[model samples]
Target: MVISLFFILPIVSIIREIGYLITSKIFGAKKSKITIGSGPKLFHLSVFEVRKYYFAYSWCSYDSLRNESKLAHIIIYASPILSNLLIALLINGLLAYELLGLPNFWNKFVFYSFYFVLFDALPIYYPDGQPSNGRVIYNLLRYGRKSDFERNDPQIDIKKTDEK
Candidate 1:
């Protein structure tokens, strides 16, 4: 319990700091740059990682709301740190519940492990209403948008990629 906090705290801090920098230096002077007068979004991005494939960025504004429905090449990239934090906290919660002190800790371990795995299986862009199959497969599995069947299990080996 005590030791776990030690690890998670620093990571949280570092991730936040990095997020600030990236959103500033990288995201640059854009239309959807955080908030100024009105304040942040209602259910907007807190943190996301997008498995490293969500670097492309594009923004879209809505007619009804003041906020723009901005979607990145990868939705997960919207808030990487927050995503990591959620995963970490879930892990800690599982640990505290299942392994604070128990003899047969494996039962809890296996059970909690699925939470991690299944959450991961949410498919990078496969959240709820994803428009395209941009790594995250939650597109077709949603309600509003139709799915784009564009997936390719590219054939490449370690030695081949390393040459570049």
Candidate 2:
């Protein structure tokens, strides 16, 4: 369980973020980054960042898309959920066919993957007010844009600087 929580979960989270990064790039995001974990910065290489709490939480961000469209935005938001679902299905299929060993570890991995998919696919706002991917997709389809709360919310501007 400890290994599943620390090792497996973080790996699954990273995979989920990669889904976002890939879809965002495919839609022509000017800049895309994946930050795995939270808290103080540990190290960052190009588009990947590892934080002090390397197993706590992870997220992906990107600048505005060059080929921006409703469909693109919807896909970008849904990518993580889809990725997790796909992984869970693949692993489950392998397990069903007895094509993989270590059934216990694989089962835990599949469980966590599906766990992520369920929550991410739920249309609800988090306690911090961030909307889940499902909520974002819902708004896109129903209102043709982000909800008014999102549009009216203050956004932080993160900029890179060159230091001598």
Candidate 3:
């Protein structure tokens, strides 16, 4: 249980971020930072940062949020989910074909990878008042205001987004 909570979860997050990074680059967005953990910085690698927790969360920063098209924002926000879902499907496909015989741990990791896509993408606050990706997207579509979908000031809810 501990291993699943700490190791597998972070791995899943990192994998998802890699997908976002790739998609962001493809879209010609400016990359600012990619953090692989929470807490104090332990080291740095160009645009990447490694922190103490290293397993708590993975965050990606980009300069592509302002004034972009609604489709672009949706792609960026959904990149992680799309990426993880693809990986999960591919791995399961291979497993079904018997082309790969991964360990039980890896099998479980694949399942968790798919699970976290739904979990993280759910539209709910994370105890810090920050909205999830789903919420942000929801607000963007619900309010019918493209200009309100800023990354820094995401439309977490309809009431808040409608104010401005």
Q: Tens-digit lDDT track for model 3 on 16-123?
A: 888778767767777566888776889999877888888876778787644366677677778888888888888888887888765576688888997878876897
lDDT of 2 by residue, 30-138 (tens): 7788888777788999999888888888888776788778899889888999999999999999999999999999999999999999999898977766678888888
Using all chains and alpha carbons, the TM-scores for the candidates as numbered come to 0.24, 0.88, 0.78
Candidate 1 structure quality by residue, lDDT tens digits, 58-86: 12211122322234312333334344445
Q: Whose lDDT is higher: candidate 2's or candidate 3's?
A: 2
RMSD after Cα superposition, model 2: 6.4
Candidate with top lDDT is 2
List per-prediction Cα lDDT, in the order shown: 0.34, 0.82, 0.72
Which is the winner by TM-score between candidate 1 and candidate 2?
2
Pick by TM-score: 2 or 3, better one: 2
Sorted on TM-score, best first, the list reads: 2, 3, 1
Candidate 1, residue 128: how far the Cα is off, in Å: 14
TM-score of 3: 0.78
Clashing pairs for model 2 are none
Number of the candidate with higher lDDT, 1 or 2 = 2
